[model samples]
Target: RSLAESLDAELLMYLAQRRITPGFLNEIDLFLRGHPELAEYTPDFVRRFNNARPLAAYRFFLKGYTRPARYVPGILPERDDQITLPHELPSVASTVDDELVDFFDGYEYRYDILRRIDDQVRALCNFLRSGGRLTWTQRLLVGLTLFGNPVDAYKHYEYNYQTEWLPHRYLPEHVVLSEVPKEPDYSVPTARVRTLDGADDKTRHTFLNTRRKMARANDAGV
Candidate 1:
């Protein structure tokens, strides 16, 4: 309830700026309050209501939210500004102070993350319409981090799946089909070529005779 209230407050503020009606807001608020379990797993619930504090935030929300909170939490970074997985490896430099990119790009690196990034983002936006709370794992998976990594890429999958205790979702069938190409191969030409090689006078003579015979046959037929 506490988490849902906070999310609803933030959502209402956002909607108001967009001129959303009071009736819609009230209905959304009611809907969020109705689904306590989903509320606890919604990304809007985490980002708006359960923003974990600094070092604690990094540990809890940023680093998988395993740490116990000792106090109130602060706001996490925005999605656009959030760190992404390294798209390219750094070139070699011999200098002592040259820094290398971190091995893990902050964006989701798993296959699942790639598949569900858009879907999770949409779901998060919808969840915000109602306002709710998301569990630590849910926050990591469904929030801005949804673009960070897919389900299969999570380091703590087995542990989280068995112990984290929440509704597990399968990858939608569309994900498997979306990136596929539909057109048949028409890029290359497929014509055949024939070659004639002359090796000796006898061979050339035989060819000439055959051609003459073919011409004679054609003339006779005509």
Candidate 2:
């Protein structure tokens, strides 16, 4: 039972990531609440079970109620119009140091900071409508990091249809039938041509005549 409950919670987490509706969350919540023995194994349910609002409880579960890190004033570099003296320095003869600095600064100054902030904001607004928290640009960047792009993700999953559902036995009978192609009948009658070889001319001619007569008789049901 403990293992089953743990598995159920894991599945619920996957569904939450897919952004299932509040009603579905409520149903799961009710199910957990009804099964007190199983509820003990699902800490997420216990944490949010007492909340008056089902949606709030669901969001808390989805986001893990994670508190964002306190904003540190100087921890993040200030983005300003003023260029620093080091940035203005001419490239050295080796060029390696300057290239390394540029690469480090590009990731440190932009990608890393933005990624952290994006994660925090996503956690904070776990319940926000589709377009609420992250802007299109932020979504594109994060999506690229995670799944490359929607088109690639779609194509990848579409090519491996089995990944989207449970195994064959668990699927509905009709759904399984719809997906599977009917097997061809290999026993159906087909025309055959026979060659009479390694025989004298008369024997070969006699065999050919006999074959023709048998074919005609069979066709006429005689």
Candidate 3:
């Protein structure tokens, strides 16, 4: 099938399974608005989604708990990334670099450093809520970040606090945890991860996504 059709299917599948984070709800609605047929195909999925919005205590999770959307790669830049640097260097580049070091450097939970990027996630979430259209790639990545494997991205990487783990961490009783009945699906391949190539997480703490439930490493030991 086409990518758009595949996305529509996966989108609904994720929604029906109650696998996505609250931050994903608005975009899921947008995808429906753009491609209305998916809703018609699974009316109950749409119905449940519409019914659940009012139940949310905070529509936008801006503080205290990190929004799962923050983990999507393009949404935020790495700390040392000069992409966000001023167009005109106000100070010597080397001097600026030396002064603002990564205090979270060598920190075990590097993903904790990600919570610092909450502003970007908030802005993007607000943008969607205001009727902005995101490219299909954005929606897909967000879907994976919010719903794919709510423990880790790849089967190989299982520790040091991955992005999907945050939703369960901050919002333990998240609305997305409720199970839904199975429905028709057009098979979509599981996203693959080849290697731990990036300079990522310092700690080895791990989690298991026990279907609708979140499982974590024991405090006593692995």
Alpha carbon lDDT of each predicted model:
0.34, 0.34, 0.34
lDDT (Cα, tens digit) per residue for candidate 3, span 4-98: 23345444454444444434545434434664554556566556545543323122111112223223344333321212323232211112121
lDDT for model 2 comes to 0.34
Candidate 1 stretches greater than 4 Å from native:
1-112, 142-222
A best-first ranking of the candidates according to their TM-score comes to 3, 1, 2
Off by over 4 Å in 2: 1-27, 30-38, 41-47, 65-222
Model 1: weakest 10-residue lDDT segment is 91-100
In candidate 2, residue 111 scores what lDDT?
A: 35
Which residue pairs show collisions in model 2?
none
Query: 1-222 in candidate 2: lDDT tens per residue?
Result: 221233355545544444332244444444444556433455454555454244344333332211111112332223221112231222121123222243234244333433343353344234233334454433323332232322212222222222222232133212212333334863423234445664334333445665664555455443
**Number of the predicted model whose TM-score against the real structure is largest:** 3
